[model samples]
Target: MKLANKRPFVTTLFLRPILLLLTLIGNYTGICKKLNVAAAELVEAKAVCATRLRLRLRQAQATATCIVTLIVLIFAGAGTAVSVQAITPNQAIDGLQQLAAQAEENGSIRVLVQLDLPFRAEGELETDAAVQAQQANIDGLQNMVLEQMADTNTAVIATFKYIPYLALELDAAALETLAALPAVVAIEEDIPVPPALSSSIPVIGADAAWSVGYTGAGQTVAILDTGVDTNHAAFTTGGNRIVAQGCYSTTNASYSATTVCPGGVEEATGAGTGVDCTAVVGPTNSKAQSDCGHGTHVASIAAGDDGGSIVGVAPDANIIAIQIFSLFNSTTYCGGFSNCVLTFTSDQILGLEHVYELRNSYNIASVNMSLGGGQYFATCDSDSRKAAIDNLRAVGIATVIASGNDGYRDSIGAPSCISSAISVGATDDVDNVASFSNIAPFIDLVAPGVSIFAAVPGGAGTKQGTSMATPHVAGAWALFKQAVPTASVDEALAAFQAGAVLVDDNRSGGVETDLARLNINNAINSYVTGLSVAVTASEDYLLPDDLVEFTVQITNNTGSVASQVVLTAPIPQPLSLDAALLSGDAAVVDGQIVWTTGQTLNPGQSLTRTVSFVVKN
Candidate 1:
C-alpha cells in the first residue's frame, strides 16, 4: 500500500486482476456439476418409458387372442343351436306331412307322432291338404295361429295329445274341440283295432306247423289287444300260452260296440285300459273290453299251447293282454267294424307307450298288434300310427301286425306297412292266401289266420280274421327268441323272413312256390351269431299244461350273455305223459321230470313238440 504512493500503482492493479480470475473459475465449476446431474436423470426416464411401452403392447396382443377365441366359440355354439332347433320343429313337421300324404294314399287316415312334438297341425288337416299346408306354416305353439284357425273358413281341424276312445264315450270337450277346428273333416273318438286283425280270416299253409319249431318256449309275447283266457286248457301254464295279462277301459259300455270275452266280464276301466279290477296283478289290456270275443280268439291263435287238435306257432310263448275297448257290450260291436272304423291315431299312441313300459318293466320280447288304421307307405314318418311303430322298433321290441281285413290288392294298413314291423297276412291251413288279406308289396309273410280256433274269455271258440293271423307271427317270433338265446333283434327278424315261403299265385290258381323257408333250429343259429355274447342255458324240461313250460339249466359259457338270461323251449301239441313220475337229476344243476298226468297217454312225447299245451275248457 505504501509502495503504491510512489511506484505500487501497477502492482495493486495486477493483484485485483488475479482475484477476478479466481472468482470466474469457481462459478464455472458449479455450473458443470448441475449439467451432469440433469443429463443422468434424463437417461433413466427414457429407459422407463421404453419398458412401459413394451408392457402395453403385450397386454393388447393377449386381449386380441382372447377376443378371437371367444368369437370362434360363439359362432360354433350358435350353429349347433340352430341345427337342433331346425330338426325338432320345421324339419319334423315337414317329415310328418310327407308321411301323412303317403298314408292317405294307402287308404289310412291315421298318422303317428312318435317324437316329442305337438300334433295339432295333423288333426287340422284331416281332410284337406291345402288347408293343412297353410296352417302347418303357423308355429306349433302359436296362440295367434290358433285364433286365426278358429276364424278361418277352411275345414282344417287340429287336435293334440289325444287318446283313442270309443266313439260313444270319448271326452266330449276334447272331441268338441277337435270337431270345432275349421279343417276338421270329422273328429272320431273311436280308435280302431290295430292292423293286428284282418277284416277277413287269414289263410295259412300247412308248413305253419313246421315253422312252430322255431318258436322257443319261455319266450314272452305281448298281446296289445283284448283280454285273453288264461284259464283255457289250450293255454300253457307257465309256458308259451298266457305269460302276463292286462286290460283297459277308455269308453262306456252302453255306447261302445266292443265285445268282451265269453265270460261277459267287462274289462276294468278308469285307467284307460280293459283290466280286471278285481285282480290286482295280471297282464291287463290298455284299451277297453270287447263283446265280440275277438281278442280272445286272436290271442288263442297267436300263443295257445299245442293241444291235441289245437296248436299255435309258439304254444310255449306267453301272452301279455292289453285291451283297448270293452268287447262285452251287446249294444256295441267293439271287436267288429264299428270299433275298427272309429279308431283314432291318438289312442294307438298311448297304447304304444304302454307297450314300451311293458318291454322295459316286464322284459317283454314281442308285441302282437292285430289292429291298425288302413294305411301304408314306402317311407316312414312320425304320424300317430307311424310314431308307435317307430318307437316300438327303436326300443328293440318286435311288433307283428295283421295286414288288414280289407281285400284291397296292393294295399296294406298302417303299422303293418311300417318297415320296422313284421306285417303278416292271413293264410289257410293249406297255405293258401286269404282273399280278404291285403295284398301288397309291403306284406312280409303269410300265416294261418282263417277260421282259426282260439280261446275266448268264457270258453274255446273258432274265429276268422287277420287278427288271428297276426298272433301267429308273434308267437313264432317268441319261439325264435327261445331257440336262439343270444339272437339279436335284427338277426331274429332276418331268420324269420328267411324261413318264410312266398306264395306267388293266389291259392285258387294252384301255383305253389316256396319263396323262403325258415327252420326253428336254423333261425336260432342265425340269431345267436348276431349277438354280442354267447348264451349258456342247457337244461331242458318238457312242461305240459295249457301252456308249454320248458326248464333249462344254463351257465354263461362265454361270459358274454347277460347275467339275467332268458330260457326258451319249443313244445308240440297232442302232448301226453305215458310213464310214471320219472324224476332224475340230469346234472347237479339240472334235472328231468317226467310225470303221468290224469289223462290217458293217447298223445305221446315222441311227436316233435314245438310248443305243447293242453286244451282247457
Candidate 2:
C-alpha cells in the first residue's frame, strides 16, 4: 500500500496514547497484573478528569468574554424509569451516565440512538445498486426498532437516510426498550451546538491564487449555520450565489426555544428560507445583534464577494446554505444573555445530509460549519455527527469546523473534536495562535482569525474567534477542490498541511502541540489561480430610449499574475464604469479598455464595474 501522502499532522494523533491510558481504567486485568502500576495509572486517569472541570469554567465564562453558549438541557419528567429498567451497554459513548441520571430524576430524556447496522456507508458498497440495497436494509432495521418501541412513551424527532441513527424524544421506558434491542449499539444526548467567523485575507496568500485564476468558480460550498445573508453583495455578485438552501431546526420546550425555520415548524426548504440571522425579532442584547449575523459573517469569510470591495477565501464559489440554528429567546437557556443563537446536534446532521445529497450534482468541495459545543479530550469518533460527516467524506466533501473559542489548552469542541472533521483553530496576523483559540492536540489546522472583517447583516463587520478561522480553511478547501477535483479529503488536507507554515504555542503553559497555519500560496506549491470576469445588465429587456445599467465583474480565479490583461468588452452603447472597482486605468484605445500595468489580483479577488447608460434617451 502506498503510504507517502498521508497527513502527518494527524497521522500521529494523540488519541491513541489517550485511549491507551483510558483502556487501563476500564478493563486491564492482565496489563495491571503484569505492570503493577494500576493504582498510579488510575490516579493519572482521574486527574485527567480535571480537564473536564476546566471546560465548564471556559463555557461559563463565555457570558462575559464571548457568545459561544454551551446549552445544558433541563431535566423534566414524570418519575424514575419503571422498576430500574435495563440500559443497554453504551459505555463506549460518553454522557450516558449523565443521561441516566437525568432520566432517573425526570423519567424522560431525549437521546440519539445509533444502530449497529449502517445506512450503507460502513463498507465497500460502491455502485448505486449496492448503496440502494444497503439503504433498504437499514430502513427495515430502523422500522423494526421503531415498532418495538412504539408502545413506550416516546416521540420520534427525526431519522437519517444515509447514517444509521435516530433522534428520539423518549421517556425512561422507551429508552430502556430501545437500548435492549439486539440491533441497537449506542445512545447519546443530542446536545445543543453554539454559533461560532473571519480575517486578514492577504496574510494567507489568497490573493496570489487570484492573480493567476482559480477563485473557486464552478464549485459550491455548503454553509450549515444560522443562515446566510443572501441579499448582501458578498453573495449577490452577478446573480444569486446561493444555488440551493435548506432549513433544519426544531422547536423544543426543553430549551424554551422555537424553530428558526420558516412556517414556525421543524423543517422547510426553498428560496429565501436561508435568510440572514435577522429572522428572530423582539430580542435585544449587546451580543444578540452581532451574534445574529454569525452565519452571514462566516459564509462571507469562506466565499463572499462584494462588487470588488470585499472578497472571501473563495470569491466565486457558489453556496449551498442550510440554516441549522434555533432561536432561544428565553434567558433561561440563553446563558443569562437576552437571546442565544444555537442548534441541536440532529440539526447539524440534517444539514450534512443535505450537502451529501447534492454531492453528485454540485462541485461541493467542502461544508463549512462554524458551530460547535461540548468538550472532548480525545477524538470523538463515536459522536452523533460523525456518521453524517463520514457519509459526506465518502462522497468527497470535506467537513470543516471551527475548533471553538473556549481558550482551553488541550481540548476542542464536540463536532470539531470528531476525528473525520478538519478542525481549524484561530491564529493572528503574526502567525501566533490566538489566546482564545482552542489548542487541542487533535486540531487539524489554524488560519488568520483576529478581527476579521467580513459581511454581516446590514453591512460589513470585524469579529475574531476560531469560528472565523474555520472558513478561511474551508475556502481554501474549495480552491483545492477546484484545482484537484479527485483529491480525497485526506489528500486535500494533506496538501494544505504539507504546504502550511508551522506555528508554535508561545502562550505560557499552553498545549505543547505544534500547529500548521494556513498559507495557500506556499501549500499549493506555486501561486497559480483562476480568474473569472462577468458582465451583466440590470435589466436584460428594457424598452427603447430607456435607461439601463450594465455590470462588469472581474473575479481573480487563482494563480499569481495575469500580464497584459484587457478588461473591456463590447456593449450596446459606449459607457464608463466606476474606476474604483478596477485595479488600473488601462490603455483606452480602439473603443476597448486594455489594462497595461501588470496588475496582481489576489486569489478570489473580484472587481465589479457598474455603468448606467441611456440607450436611446
Candidate 3:
C-alpha cells in the first residue's frame, strides 16, 4: 500500500512537551503501566520503524508497564486505606441496596419515604410504666391503642408518606403557627391612601390661599403606577429640586400578545412606554403609552414645578415610581381578550408594604393612593383592607385616597370607604363637583379634580383624572404637618375640614346636586390662629342646694387683640358649668373669641390671674 503524503514533524514536536508532562503525571500517580501500554500501540503505528528498533521499543514498553502496574497498586492501596478509615459500613453497599429493595417490596414503601422519618428506633425499648399510665389518662385517649403502643422497652417504627399531587398538608393550625414563626419577618394590615385635589381655580382667595398651605419640600411621595421617566422637568423641579427617595422599576416579566411592558405611554416629546402601532417591527415597539398617562400626569400635577405651565399644588414634593399596571395600552388587554382587567393585588400589596417600610424606616409622613378597585360583591365590614389602613395609622402615617371615578352613586370601593383615610371627591375649575367623581358619606372633602393639568412621564404633557385629585391632598397634608408641628392626626384632619370651602349648589344649598353646584368663595377661610380661653372652678366641691360663684378671663389671637370673648361648654349630665360665669366681652365668631377680656389684650397677652368660682354640689 502506498503511504499518504506526510507533513513535516512540526506537529509532533509540539506534542512532545505535552507527552513529557503526561509522563511526569503518570510517574507521580503510579499509572506508568497504562502509559507503557499506550507507548506499545504508538510503536506499532510507526510505518518506518525497523525490526530491531521495534523490539527495543517493545522491551522499553514492557519495563514501563511493570512500573505502571506497581504505581497502580500503590494508588489503589492508598485509596483503599482512606476509604477504610472514613466510613465503616455494617453491611456491604450492594447488600444494603438489596435489603432496601426487599423492605420496599414487603411494605410498599418508597426509598424517599424511609429517609423522611425524623427518628428511628434501632432496638428494644426501656421500660417506663409510670409515664405510659399518665399519658393514657389524657383526654381523647384510645385506651387499647395507647396500651399497645406505649411499651417503653419495645422497638417502634415511624413513617412518612407522600400524598398524590399534594406536596405537603399545611393545615390551618400549621398556617397560624407559621404566621407566628421567627422566619416570618413581618405581618401587617393593608392600608388605603387615596388621592386629593384642589378647586380648578389656581387661587383659593386670600384666606384660603395658604388655607391648605404646604411646601412639600424635602418630603417623598411615592406614586405606585406606570414607570416614570426620572429626567422629567416637572419631577426634577426644573433642574433645581430632586427627591432623594430612591426609585425602582418592577414591570411584569411575562409578556402577552395584547400587552407589552415598558412601552405604550407617551410624553410631550412623544416618547413613552408604547411603540409605533403601524410598524410590525418584532417586539421592540408597537403601542402608545399616552392613552393611560393618568398616573404620571397625576403625580406631576400634584408636585410638578417646571418653572411654568401650571405649578403643582405641592411643588416641592418627591416622587416614587411604581408600575403595577402597564401604560403601553390605553385599555389594557391581555391574552387576545379586550378590556381584560388583570387584578394587580399582589403588586398593590407589595407597593403598600414598600411604602409602609419607607415610612417606618425613613419617616415618610404622607402617601397618596390614586388607584381604586371596582365595587365588587364584598361589603366594607367584610373587607380585609382595614388591616392596611389601621397599620398605616398605627405608625402615625397619613394617607389620601381618591374616591373612585365611578359616577355610580352609593357604591364607593375599598380603601376609600375605609374609615381611616381621607377620601376626596372631585371638583371642577368652576367649583362644581365633577360628573365622574363618585360621592359617598365616606368622602372627607372635594377638590379640583376635573380637566386638571398635570405632569406625565418621559417629559410628557399633562393629563387628567380623579387620580390627579389625590396627590394634591397628600402634598397639602405634608404642608399642614410642616405648618403645625404639634398637630395630631385628628387635629390635622380637623384643620383640613375647617379650611375647605363649603361646596354648594346654585340654589345656595351647601351641597349642590347638578350643573349649578359651585363652591362658596370664602367658606373655608380659617387658619391655625392660636387658641386661648380661661376656665374657673366653682368651689372644688359642690354641696346640695348652695349657689356657686365664678369668674372668667379671655385673650385674643386672631391677628389682632381686643377684649370681649365668649366661651360655650357642652354640659354633660352630672357635670354642668355655669354658662353665665363665662365673663369678658362674650362675642362668638365661628367657634372662636372676638376680643380680649380687658378690651385690648394684644396678640401675645394672656389673662394674668385665674378666675374664681363657687358651685352648689
Candidate 4:
C-alpha cells in the first residue's frame, strides 16, 4: 500500500501515539466482551488483554526501526535526490554568501570552500599512493567548479589538498551557484587575521631554566607570522640558529629553500649553499624583514639569542620562519587595528601544511602563532584549519596560539579556540591579566605580555598583547621538548599545567581568575628533570645529647641528565648538626646541613650523603 506521506514515519513521536491508541482500543474491546462473562473470567480476560497490549507496543517499536530502514532504502533508490546532512552547507557559508551580496563593491571575493571527506583516525598513516588518490579526488572536484567558473570567466585562485578545500575568487552572483554544488560543504569569506602583538621572561622562570643549562639547544620552533629578520642580532647565531624559511602568502611566489621569492637573495652565503643548507628564503617584505616588525618581535620572544640586555625564553632553540602575511597595502585594513598587516585563513593553512612537510627536516618541537582574528566560541568552526592543527599536533609539534586581544569574555578566536591548541592569554609583569587579553575557559596559560621587550626588526623594542604571551609558552615547550625528545604534545601540556603557578588574584575586576601562570623553572624541576629527594634518620629514637646519623638521597628518574642539584636539610627541632661530622661536600650552616656545591645526577642515577647530628633535650 502507498504511504500517506513520502516523509519517513519512523520517528517515535508518530508511532507512540498510534501504539497508545491501539492499546486503548484493545482494552475497551476486551472490557465490552468480558462484561457478559463471570467475574473470574472477566478478570482473566483483562489480564490477557494487558499482555497483548504490551506485546503490541513492543512490535510497534520494532516496526518503527523497520520503517526507518525502509526509508533509507527508498532514498537510496531515488539516486541524487537523497538528502544528506553531511554535504549540506553550514551557517557560516550562508552568512558569507549574504555578506557577499550586501557588499556594494563589484569585485570578486576570496572564499574558502570546504568539502566533506572520508574520516581518518588520529595518527593513521596513509601510503603515498593513497594520499595522492585522495588528493586527486579533491582536485577533480575542485577542477569541476573551476571549469564551471571558466565558462563564466571567473578565475580559480588556489587549491588545498592538505585539508580538502579550495581558495578561489568568485563573484557575488556566482556564490549561490558554486555553493549549490554537491561537493561543496562550506564556503567562508577569507578574512584578514591580524597580528595579536611580548615580555619579561624572568617572570615566567625561564632564567632559572637557563641557569640550570636547559637552553632548548636541540629543539626548533616554527614561527608563522609576517616574517623574521635574518639579519637581526637576536637570530644571528653565526648562521646556525635560523634553520629554514618559506613564504606561503598568495601574493608571494611558491616554496623555495634557497631563494625567498623569484629573485630574492639567500640569507646564507658559502659552501653549504642551495640544497639542504640552513638558510631562509622569502620576499624582503615577507621574509626576515618586517615593515610592522611584529613577526620579528614574536620570533625573539620565542627563540632569539641572548643579548646582554634581553634573552629569549628558549635562547638556543633554532627558528623556522614561515611568512603567512604579505606586505599590507593601503586597501587591506585588518579590522581597523593597523593598516600594515593582513593575512588569510588560506595562508595560515598553507603555512601549517608547509610545517608538516618540513617536520622531518627541521624536527620542529613547537609552533608559535601570535596572530588570529574572528572570534570563535568553544570549538573551531573552520574544518580545514582545525584539521591542519590536529595533523601537526598528531606528529608531535606543540601548537601554541594566542587567545586574541578582544578583551571580551570567552572571545578566544579561531585556531586559538581549537581544543588541541595550547591557548595562551596575557598577564602583566605582576601576574595580573592584561586588560586587552581575551579571557575564556579554554585559556591554558598566561604569561607576561605587557610592555614586553624583545627583538624588533630594527632593534629591541617592547609590545603588548596575548601574542606576546604565546611565545613564552612556545619557548617553554621547546625547553620541555629538549629535555624529553619523545614527549607528545599532550604530555608537554600536562607538564606545563602541572608546573604552572596558580594566580587566584591580580586579575581584572578584582575577581579571582583560576588560571595558572607560566613557571618554566617549576616545569623543569618538576616535569623535565624529575628530580626527587628522600631523607631518613639512622635511628628513630635518641636520648638527650645522643649522637644520630642522617642519610639523604637524591635521584634523577628522567631520560635526561639533571645538573646543579643541591639538597637542603633543615636540622630538626631539638637537634643540632655538627660541622665536623659533615661528609661528601656537606656542611653545617645555621643548624642546617647544606650541600653548597651542587652535583650532577645522570639519568636514573642517585647520590647519597651522610651527616651526624647531636640531639639535645
Candidate 5:
C-alpha cells in the first residue's frame, strides 16, 4: 500500500538501525521460529542486497516512505487493534474463543465486552436532557450489539453505561463473529474478585477528643460494604442510628436494579424497622447476614456505641449502610476451597451513586469504603468509581478508603488510589504497620486495624485488615467535621494527616518504610485554639475505695501562649479527690476538680500535674 505522508529522511533515521538489528538477529538464528509471523515477515521482507537497500532508501528519500510506515502501523496495532487486525482476531478474543471451545459441552460462556469510546465529562452531561441523550447513545450501541448477536442467535446479558461495556453469553461461533465486529475493543471472561479481609480507638487518641466532648455527634458517615445489622446496639439508641440503607449488589439477583433496595424501604427511622433488602446470595450459598459479617463490623467500627465496651471512633455519629457486596456462589477456586464471591465493581459504583444522591438529606460528612480490590499503581481517575467519588467530594463529602491488603509497594487499589479519597493503611496496637497493608505514596494515614474489636451481626467480634483501618479514619473525619463545622474536605484531610504520628514497620515493602498513624486527638487539637488536656490514670482497673492517682497533661499547641489555662476534671460518683494535696488555685466546684493555673503557657509548651483521689464504695 502507498504511504499517505512522506518523511523519508526521519523515517529512515529511526527505522534503519531497527531493520538492520532485526536482519542480523534473524539470520544468526531462525528468528521466525521464535518471533510471531508479523515480526518475521517484516524482517524477511526488508531483507535485500546492501546496494539494493541503499538504492531503495535513496529512491524513498526522493519520493516516499512505505516500509517504515507499514512497520510502524503493524506494531502499533499488534495488541490493541480490534478492527484492523480482527481479520486475525486479537489475543483477548482469541483467548475467549479457546475458552469457548474448552467449555463446549457446557454450552456458552459469559464474557465482558469492553468497547472504545471518547471521554465525556459527567458535568457536561449534568442536565437531565443531556444525561438522557448520553444514555440514549449507550442504549443505541448496546442495541446494535444485541441485534448483531441475534444473527448468531446470541444475546447480551447486561449493559454497562458508566463505561461503554456489555456482558454477553456466547458460543465459539458467536464469540468469533462478535470479535470481528469493529465496535468490540476487548472480550474477556468475568473474573471473580474475593473480599480482602480491623482496632482500638485510644491508640489513635480518639479518647482525648471524646473527653473534650467532640464525639462525632450529629454527623453521618455512610458505609459502603456488605450490609449493616441495624439491630446491633452499636447502631441503635432508642432508634436506629442507621439513617438510611440500600443494597446495590447483584448477588441476590432480585436486587440487581440499582434504583432502590429490593423488599426494603429506601429509608427508615429505627433499627429492624427499616429496609429489609434482599441479602446477597452467591452460588456458593452465602448470605450478607449469615456468611458475610463484614458490613456490620465496619459500620460498628465507624459509628457503633455498644455502651462503651466496643465504642466506635465516632460513637454518636449516624450511619448510612450502603450494602454493595453479598455472598455469591464462586465459579472458581478460592484459596483451595469454593467460597462465594465478595463484591463487584459495578455494585461499588452504584453504592457510591446512592451516597451522592443522599448527601443532601443526611448531610453526609464522610464516606467509609473499607472495601477495595484491583491493584492500581497510580491514581485511577479514569475509573467510573473514581468519578463517583470525585462527584461526592466536589459537594463536600470526604471518601475514606482502605489501601488494599496486597502488601506490595505501589499496590494501593482503585477508589482508594483516587486522589480525592483518603487512603488508609493498617497499624497494630503498638503503632507498627500491619504486614498485609498495601503501602504507596497514596496512603494518607494509618490506623489500628490488627485484631480490631467491633460489632458484628451477632453482637461483637474482632477482625483484621486495612478494611478495619479505613473506618477509623472515616470516623476521625466525622469527629473533625463536628469539631470544626466549617472545615472543607481538603481542610479535614490535611488536619488528619498533620495529626498522624509516624510509625516504623518492616512490612512496608515499598519506598515508604514508615507510615503516619492516625491520631484523632492531635487532629482535633490542630484545629482548636486553646489548651488541650489529656488525662490518664496510673491504674486502669481501680477497685472501689482504693486510692487512685491521676495525671493530667495540658499543652498549648496554638500560635500564641494560652493565658488563664484552667484544667477541669469532672468527678463522677464513687470518686473523691483529696483537697489538701491540691495546689495553685485548685478548688472543688460543682463536683469537679478545677485547677485554675492562672499561668501563661507558651506555644508548644506543656504542663503536667498529679492528683490523688480515692474511689468511693
Candidate 6:
C-alpha cells in the first residue's frame, strides 16, 4: 500500500506454481526453435485463464470477483500438452475487509483512514472564527484517534487540516480496533502518486489577454512539481517573479531514493528549498538521469516571464514553487524502471495543505500539479487529495492538473480524476488531441502541449505532454483572477468552458471525446465584468424575407473606462444582413458581423449599433 510495501497472500502461496508453468511454456518454445522439432508437437493451445481477481466488500465482508483471461499459446513440450496455471492475488482493496486481509497477509498495513465527521468547505465557514472552531474539532478528532491506537503498533504518518483523514501505519489488531470505533468511516490504501510526465502563449490567445492589460499582475500561481530552478533566466527576466518556495519530497527506504529536499530533509521551506533536484534519479543506463527539470519546465509554462524569448501564459504572474516528488528505485513502484520519479500521496497532500495555509497571504488564483499516476474513467472524488481540493475551491483557489500522458481514450489519471480538480488533456498546434494525451468524458479541457518551448533548469528547452497542457490553464486562471478579482474558481472555469472550442479526439480503438480546447481571449471577452451588453429587435415575429431591425447596446458598469472594446454578432442562416443599414465600422466576416471600437467606453456609458436583417426560410 505504501510504495511497493505490500506483499499479499497469493504471492507467497501460489507464485512458484504459476512461475513454473510459465517457465515450461517459455523453455519449450525456445527448445523447439533451436532443435528443429516437429511443428505438430508444439501445437496451438487456447486457454481461458481462470485468474480470480478478488475485491472485498467494505462492511459486508463479501467477495466480488473479476477475471483476466489469457488466450492462444503454443503449448506441448516433449510431445505432451503443457498447461498454464494462473494464480490471482486476494485483491482486497477497500474498507475493513481489506484491512483484515492485508493484516493476515502482511501483519500490518499503511492506509488513509477517513473519519465519519464531514469536513466543511472554506466558504461554508463565513468567518475566520468559524474556520478556527472547525479546525479545533478536527484536531480533537485526530487526538482521539491517536489515543485509541496508542496501545498497538500504530504510527500516524501524516495529519491533514483540510481533509478529515490520517495516513497511518498500523498492525492488523490496531486496524480492526480502529474500524470498530464509531468515528472511523472507511479506509483505503495510501497509494503512490507518480510523475505522469508545454507551450505556446499565442495559440491559446494569451497575447490578446496581455494586450488588454490582463497579464496576471499581482496574482500568484502555485506550482507543485519536482522543483524549479529559481535562478533560471525564465523566472527573473522582467522582475524577481519567484516569490515563495517550499519542498515536500518523500523518501521511503523500500521504494524511494534519498530525500530530495535541501539538506536531504523530507520537507523544508524558504529560499533555496525549491531548487532543481540535480541528483541521478533514473536508471544507470539512462543518459540523463541527473536532469530533473520537470518542475522548472512546468513553472515557466504557467507564469514564467523571461524577457520576450520564452514567456509563459501569465507573463507577469508570480510563482510559489514547491517540490513534491522523490526518486523511486523499486521496479514494482517505478513501473518496471530500475529508477524513476515518483511521489507519495501523503507528500502531495501536505504540499497542497501548505498552499491552503498561504492563501490569505498571497493573491493565489490556482495551483498547478502536472503529476499523476493510474487512470480512472469516473471522478475519483474519494481520493485523499479531494478534501484539500474542495477546501481550496471553497475559497476561490483552483487546482489544475494534467489528465496524464497514457494515451487512454476513455480514462484519465488520479488527483486529476478527482471531480473538484480541473483535469486538462493535451492538444497540438493544429487543435487535434495529442497521441500521448489521456482523454475521457471527465476531462475538463485541452491546451496546446505538443512541442512546447519552456524553461528548463539551465535554459529554455522544448518538451510536451499533458503536463505542459495543464500550466496553460493554470496561467489562464491567474489572468482570470487578475481581470476579475472577485471571480470564484467555478466562475472562472465556467467562463473558460463557455468560450472553449470543442475538439474531437478520434484516435485508436476507444470511445471518442469532444473536449474543450482552451480559448483564453474568448473566455476573457465573454466573461461578465465591468461590461454588459443587451440586444433588442423591432419585431418579435417575421415571415420569410421580412425586414427586421436589430440593435446591440454595450454598457460599461465599472468606475473606470473599459478600453479595447470589441463586439461580434453571429448571423444565422435564416437572417440576411442589409449592408446599407449596418452601423458605422461594422463589417461581416465568416457569417458574423465584427466591430472594433478603437476608443474606450467610460463609466456608466452605453453604445448602441443598429442593423437591418431579413428572415429567410
lDDT of each: 0.46, 0.71, 0.43, 0.68, 0.66, 0.75
Which candidate comes out best when scored by lDDT? 6
- Candidate 2 stretches with Cα past 4 Å from truth are 1-97, 104-107, 118-124, 197-199, 276-282, 286-292, 526-617
Which ranking of candidates, highest lDDT first?
6, 2, 4, 5, 1, 3
Position 379, candidate 2: lDDT:
94
The clash count of every prediction, one per candidate, is 135, 33, 50, 6, 11, 1
User: C-alpha displacement of 134 in model 1, angstroms?
Assistant: 28
Each model's TM-score? 0.49, 0.70, 0.47, 0.67, 0.61, 0.77
Model 5 lDDT-worst window of ten: 251-260
Which tens-of-lDDT digit does each residue in 1-617 have in candidate 2?
A: 13344334234343433454455434444433454445545443332233223323333343322211111111213463333332334454456667777776766776888876634453346565556555655565567678878888888888788877888887666666666565577898877767763337788878866665668988788988888878888898778888998999888776666787767867877896776465554355433534348888888989999976678999999998898877777676567777776788888888888788888789998999887876788898878788888888877889999888888888988789988899999989998889988888878999998989898887898889998999899898888777667778877777677567667888877854448888775555422234455658678676655565556666666544344334433233445433334332443344334443245556576666555544432
Query: Per-residue lDDT of 164-280 in model 3, one digit per residue for the tens?
Result: 000111222322332222212222221212222223434433223333344566565666554455566776655633333222222322222123233332111113332222222
Model 4, CA-based lDDT? 0.68
Q: Write one digit per residue (lDDT tens) for candidate 5, span 434-513.
A: 88888787678888889988887657888899888889988988888887766778777777765666665565354674
Error of 3 at 246 (Å): 6.9
Predicted candidate 3, C-alpha RMSD = 26.4
TM-score-best of 2 and 4: 2
Collision pairs in model 4: 198-452, 198-468, 228-288, 229-288, 260-281, 260-282
Q: In candidate 4, what are the lDDT values of residues 190-268, reduced to their tens digit?
A: 6656688634777888887887778889889998876776777887754558887776554522111122222343222
Task: In angstroms, give how far residue 224 of model 1 lies from its true place.
Answer: 1.4
TM-score of 5: 0.61
Number of the top candidate by TM-score? 6
Location of the lowest summed lDDT over 10 successive residues in candidate 2 = 67-76
Q: What are the runs in model 3 whose C-alpha is more than 4 Å off?
A: 1-214, 238-292, 327-343, 360-363, 376-381, 458-462, 504-617
Question: In candidate 6, what are the lDDT values of residues 1-617, reduced to their tens digit?
Answer: 53244335434334544554555556544554555434322221110001001000222121111111121122124575546664322222355676677766766677887765657886767766556555655665677778778888887778887677888877778877777654566687767666556336778888888887889999999999888888888898867898999988766653445568878798899988877555655656742224457888889989987786788899899999988777666776665667766677888888999999999999999999998878798998878888889889988999999999989999999889999999999999888899999998878999999998998877877888999999999999999888888988888888888667666796766476447889788777666665677879899877776787767777887676777676655566566666655555677775567776667888898888776655554
Model 5 score (lDDT): 0.66
